[model samples]
Target: MMKYSTSPTPSTSSYPRSTSPLPAPANYQPTTASAAVKRYKYLRRLFKFNQMDFEFAAWQMVYLFVAPQKVFRNFNYRKHTKSQFARDDPAFLVLLSVWLFLSSMFFALCIGLSSGQIALFVLFVVFVDFIGAGILVSTIFWYVSNKYLSVDGAGGDVEWGYAFDVHINAFFPPLSLLHCFQILLFHNLLSHSGFLACFVSNTFWLASIVYYLYITFLGYSNLPMIKNARAFLLPLPALFVLYVGTLLANWNLSHMLMDFYHYRVL
Candidate 1:
């Protein structure tokens, strides 16, 4: 009896309501539960690389090599050349090598004059090879994906960003794979403390072989036209042999330089 009737418990229709239709969802809104899972599955399948590591390598290379248009053109060159290591930006590579070498020397001199200095130099070299090589590999991927690998046989005409989509996709695997090899090389190199580390630095040699194989496989796999595994491997073996010759040449040059310095000091 003491309780009020609460104004007839407020009829369901008593609440204020808008007469206009509800707003549509924004375009950038996240997918719902089922759709989100589906989207993730597709993304995972597409990338086929370690997500976080690949992303880091991609970002590093992106910052290091950010030419908008020419980056993709290089891929076109690679497609025609068939596994040839075409030089896109020689000046950039030379400048980076010089900068890294000089910077390492400067740091080595500043820090100490012992095996420790050499160790630091080696670390710097590894960094340059990993990050610098990362940029190169990313650029290559961008080109091939844009030029050769296509769902429909019709990619695009040679425009400014003919390979923009391919470039975006290329940023990940090559860098990820390269970084993985770099780690392996660093581990092997650091484990020893001599100038002529065992077998003339086969760490990078083997790593490069692995990297080349992966790139060839990736390119062939993505493209419907060039699916012949045998055809792909033919060019790769020759490239690998050439790379070995280059490695030996580089080693001999470094050895001679060191010997000259030692003689001059004596």
Candidate 2:
């Protein structure tokens, strides 16, 4: 006791002594820290992508880029990949079409073409937009088709078959409009007061989009096999409804424009 009092008390190491004696499971696997982390992260991603059973790596990469982060941020990616990916919602298409149509009309009338020549000019703008849409859609289809064929051994050509699915939503239409809008803005800046010129340009844009949608639909839908038959047919009913809706919307928008103009004058 006298000798111990002279020296400092010995400290215990970090390791703890367990009083309970529990046997370790016989088949317990010791996972490395890095491997465990990777597994956990993968599970989170899987849960986030909603376990979309994406077969091809190309689409997976596309999803990783295009997909909204909110869809996956809370989950483990690893756990979700065990299943198949589901198709996009049909309502999303309808909503996108409506929004695109409304936006196009507004931009064409207000900025691209003057409010005075709203009708014909808007139509023209829509036409040019469609043409550009065709090119863009075709390119996307080509890229996806090539990727899909390389991986899955399906889709004969990039022309009309599987390409229809590529343009099912208002994806191409809106994208093309965005591109045309930028160029048209530049044109508007250059020729500030030439309504007729702007109208003509806008007409070309609209006509191009209409033509592309029509031709592409006819080409893909009328194909020999059941290639895009399902996708094409699905849109027909929706387009009919959209056509009627667009007329009503355009009419209402026109009235609103007139009211605003009158109010400004008053």
Candidate 3:
């Protein structure tokens, strides 16, 4: 009547003026609720030995040293399928914890630590070096990467758990190199004051640091939303300079580390 045309009325279903928001997909949910659920589930299974997938964690450990980039590829797949980058299974953490314990024991023995000293040594390594430092580092990287390195309008956020995982991954090769392999050769080579000892020990330290940086780069670069992950490797040149400095100064890193640990425990 009032010059109405053939335009049809907008469907309420498609163009609602007011309605509840859509439900999240199965893999995606509100953050607080999802985090609470995940935490509860992860902790509940922590002591439940049978429920943890140790095999997968072992596989990750092997790949971490030999083919580290391949290890991160699985993280990408997990992000797609689980809608999160962090691991749900506690197996890797469990394996890492066990490794830290065993390696620390061997380290204490190699350093001629007494029973009480060994206890203190293991406690320092497991608690301060691994857990406390891990949390601090994880928080720092999580904040920095999300704040500065995340791509603009990338949408997804970096989880603290994922950051911790990266730390543990980077920590592994160094632990084995320093605690296990270095211990094997400590008395023979690394503890000596010879040039060959300086070169070899410093080289091992250099390699350990490089592994940490490279693994960290792989972890962050694997993320679809992260940019400039090459920033992780930026320290390599400085580390090399420091390595050469240590060699020239005849600073046996492993010997110094042994002395430091023994001093701490004493």
Which candidate has the top score in TM-score?
3
Off by over 4 Å in 2: 1-88, 112-117, 121-149, 152-266
In candidate 1, what are the lDDT values of residues 111-162, reduced to their tens digit?
3336655665556454654455555655564455445543455432222222
Better structure of 2 and 3 per TM-score: 3
**Candidate 3: tens digits of C-alpha lDDT, residues 129-227:** 999999999899999999999998877788888998999999999999988987888888777888999898888899898999999998988776788
What 10-residue stretch in candidate 1 is worst by lDDT? 5-14
lDDT of each: 0.39, 0.38, 0.81
Top-scoring candidate (lDDT):
3
State, as a TM-score between 0 and 1, how close model 1 is to the true structure: 0.30
Give the per-residue lDDT digits (tens) of candidate 2, residues 70-185: 12211111112211111222232333345556665665555435565566544543454444564576566556434433333432334331253335422444344443443355
| Best-to-worst ranking by lDDT | 3, 1, 2
Question: What is the alpha-carbon lDDT for the whole of candidate 1?
Answer: 0.39
Clashes of each: 1, 36, 0
